[model samples]
Target: MGHAICEELEAHGENFIVIDKNESRTETLRDEKFDASVGDISHKDLIEKISMPPTIFVVSSDILANISFTERVRKQYPNVTIFARAADESTKEELVKKGANHVILSQEIVSNVVYDKIKKLEDSADAQKLLRVLKETEEKLAIIVHDNPDPDALASALALKYIGNGVNVESDILYGRGIGHQENRSFVNLLDIELKKIEDTDLNRYNKYAFIDTVPDANNSASVTPNIIIDHHEVTESIPDADFVLIDANCGSTAAIMTKFIRELNVDIPKEIASALLYGIRSDTQDFTRNTSPADLTAAAYLYPHVNYELLKQITSSVISVGTLNVLGDAIKNRKMRGSYLLSNVGFIRDSDTLSQAADYLLRLEGVTTAVVYGIIEDSGIYISARTKDIRVSMGEVLKEAFKDVGSAGGHNGMAAAQIPLGIFDSVKDKDSLIYLCEEAVTKRFLAVVGAEDEK
Candidate 1:
């Protein structure tokens, strides 16, 4: 294991030195062009003679010897990071008490390896099922994303399209509403990703349909039943019938699941696809600060080497549009505080994505534990975006209970969104009265659900 670790470090062009009591092993490492020395690692005289690096690894099979070496190193260099290997739990605890920064157990490492192999087999099976479904497509497959697709939705759609192409099946990436988010638009433009507006495209031409990052009952505009459904959202309702379903609420984003499929299937990820998936994971997880899972981080690490950093930078640093600025201004001006809760009404907006931006911004205010921003989208309806730093409140559940009968709403614990149809308010000719009614209803319901209705 120690030699294997050394090989990995060497493969990554990392500077490392190898020490062993076996002269033959030291000679072999030296012959392989490694910096090596034969010495008793526990001996104080030998340890004092060599220059110690900021980090050291002790991986000898002898548990007593490893413990002795770790204690000696810790006493000599108190601040140095010691990564030591232990054979069991007792040894690990003892090593930690001896000032080892990290201790890896042999049994734990073996168990992890076994678990990964089993997981890979399971992923491979799932990938094959998806391929079979794609192969059954007589004509082109239509990959549908939610309305006004975010980075996670867009990237997952792209990955499915890539998979479809691998099976010699033509696919078109379809979306409902316009991609109004500036950063999302930049992502599509920079990656040269091809997407067709569902309204403009002839949906009848496709023989099969697949939904990514969303389900049919969600806010998506597609009416057709999907053949394949992949999403990371918590399943709040009965999923529509589908040939293949991969819904893992544990994942931070659907992009992470897609990344796993790409890896297990051994598909060579294109630089554009890699970059998109990486950004998608980062965006949906709020840079791994919210609703993140081990799978999400693993996916990001897998794509890091293949990602196009320049394109990712351009996508994230997109210029905020005038509409977004106006919405932000309105949100700030109209913000109402109820204790630590902040709610804002942006009145009417051409782009609903700005609500989320406003909500995110408002959550940064001092002493504010939660922020909710809402805006009307003329003909569509009223859109609400919420953010919360309070762990006691699950924003998704709050929004769902607040608007259960009136609209569709659900999201992670930290962030959530909702859309309510205009209904009778669509006929209101007076704009001010309409805005007042909407504000009153939204604010009251939200506050009531969060148990802040009585708070001033």
Candidate 2:
């Protein structure tokens, strides 16, 4: 196993050292022009003899030996990454518990390699289809993002623009609504991305339209037919009848799918663009905490070195307003727990985006796996934002089924929102009445939809 690993690393032109207790193995590695040492890796003195600690220590010996070596390394140099090979589930767990950064089962690795090869072939075919679309189009195209575009939507749009530029096809990134959240605004400003409001732009000026991060039937998307739809959201509703649809719900983020395009096209990703795409993937996947897939991690890895770390720091660390903080406090104070689900009403808020933020915060409460926060937005309407860690619940479908008759609603499985126009509750007399009406209507409808046992 050690010899095979050394050979593979050498094939990739990577510098590595081999440490083995067996003289013959050490001699064999040395014969192959590799740095070899004969010693027990678990010995502190033996490891210290190596000039410098490696960035990654590969443990390919038997499970017991690997675990022993990993534990020893972690004790001395806790920061060093350990990649250990395990023969079975028991050994895998032991290696992981002993501080292996990654534990690989030989069988699983072999199977995954085969699966990846097949996936690559399929990706190549799709890349050809994408190139055909770009090359065949003679006129300019419009890439429309969902309303109140977030980092994921904006970054995906930017990536598509890059792809369009590579093919010599002109494209403009457009959004149906303005960015409202503090983080989103910071992302756009820091990245220097230009997104035109679709309402202001003349749609007819563009010969074809494309949708990124959202489909035509989405409540947040503009009411326009698209020639291409590239999104990572689930197929919960009717998709846009685009000439080419590249929807991969398994990717976790639209940016992941767009990043794949950038790589397949062999186009250079600028530092600004790389930073934006990395931020998009992190934001959409909640830093790989919510609904993340392997592809999302892979895309993030690809963009890591090229990204502008300083700009990403600024974008993520942007300050939130006192109003948003107050709303979050109010949501927490008014929260009612039902099983693992918590529901709250913030009374009133001018920025409806605050509801989503509050819902996300409430979901972190102990014992609460799902949270629904609602508030009345001044002049606009009543808005409901829901978030869930429970895989059984599809937040988007829940919101749709709860209030589809009264308002526009839809989102991903883990997060969703709904809006009901104030005109629907015309019977309200005063501020107190309006608040009570909103609370009653929203709570009853949401609880009914989610089928919670009780609300307290």
Candidate 3:
């Protein structure tokens, strides 16, 4: 087992030394061009003579020898990282207590390999199921995304449409509300992804409907029952029944799930599709800084080589629009700070997406650990965008607990948003009074949930 590990390390071009108690075994390793020495690993004289690197690995056949070597090395070099092999759980625990930074168990490694294989098989089955459903579509298919669709939603919808095309089922990407973010608009225009407004499209023409990146809900304007639903958000409300539903809260983005399907089904990924999916994963995961998983990283890695870097740069570096700048100005001027929390009112705005940008910007303030920006739309309701770096707080839960009775709210731990219908607030004609009431109500509700209300 240790020889196999050494071969792998050598194949990866890593520098490592081997120690063995048997002189013939050490000579054999040296003859094979390995840095080998015949010495007892637990001997203080042997350890003192050898130059120790920042990391040491003790993977002998004997668990007792491994533990002794780990303890001796830790006592001599307290700062070095030690990886020790163990025979069982008890030996693993003993190695850890003796200051082994990592314990590698063959059984655990085998179990992980088995789990990965099973997961791959399950994913393949899911892909086949989705393809079967797409092939059954009589007329055209409608791949609808959430309102004001972001890159993740757009990419996933496009991936589904690509898959649908493979089975000769024509599909259209549909979205409710306008894409208000500058970067989102650039992504669509640059990629030449065709999308139709849900209000403008004839819903009756499509025989099959697939919702991507969002489930059927009151806010999404999903009038008809969906045949399919694929999403990554935590399911707050019970999902409406669908023929094929793949909702993985563990995934960082819906694009990652779609990437898995494309790979499992052996569909050739186009460069444009790869670029879009990679950007979708990056955007939704905040470049893997928030709510990311190994699946998301693996998906990104697979898509990276095929992505168009030039187009990606253009989409990500889109200039802020005049409306967004105006909103940011308002947010900065009206900022209110209480302890580590900062709240700002951007006043009435046509674009709600700018609120999140402003919240992200406000979170960079020196002392602020949590930032919230809110605004009201004319016919719509008050929109709230929140961001937090405090690991103790879940922004999603905070927003949900604060406004569950009055509106809809949910997201990841670090970022969340909410929308409350303008019920009684619509009657307030005075702009100043409306801003005051919105600020007071929003601040009190939000701060109360985070337990920062008592702070002056």
The best-first sequence of candidates by TM-score reads: 1, 3, 2
Model 2 stretches astray by more than 4 angstroms: 1-114, 426-431, 453-455
Candidates by lDDT, descending order:
1, 3, 2
lDDT of 2 by residue, 1-456 (tens): 455555665664556777788899788878878998888765667767775543444455566877887887788887565667788999999988988867777776643343344356456656667777877778888998887788999999999888888889998999864576899989889888888887798888888788889888574546677888898887667775667888887788999988888887777899999999999999989999887988899999999989988999999899998878999999989998878889898887777778889988888888999999998866668888899989988998888988988887877889987889899877775877898899888888888988864655
Q: Which number leads on lDDT?
A: 1
Candidate 3, residue 268: CA error in Å?
0.6
Whole-model lDDT values for every prediction:
0.88, 0.81, 0.87
Tens-digit lDDT track of model 1 for 1-456: 777767766754557899899999999999999999998876768787889986777888888888988998899887576778899889999999988877878766543343344355557768877888989999899999988899999999999999889989999999888888899989999988899998898899998999999889677888897899999988688988889999988899999999999998898999999999999999999999999999999999999999988888899889999989999999999999999999999898998889999999999999899999998888888999999999999898899999988998878889988989998576787888889989998999999999999998
Error of 2 at 31 (Å): 54
Instruction: Please write out the lDDT profile of model 3 over residues 1-456, one tens digit for every residue.
Output: 667766766764557898889899888899989998887876768787899886666877788988988898889888677778899999999999999877888665443343344366568768988999999999999998877788999999999999999999999999887788899999999999998988998899999899898878634666988999998888777888888999888899999999999999998999999999999999999999989988899999999999999999999899999999999999999998999999999889998889988998899989999999999987778989999999998898899899988887878788888888888686788888987898888999998888888996
Predicted structure 2: lDDT: 0.81
* Candidate 1 to native Cα RMSD, angstroms: 15.5
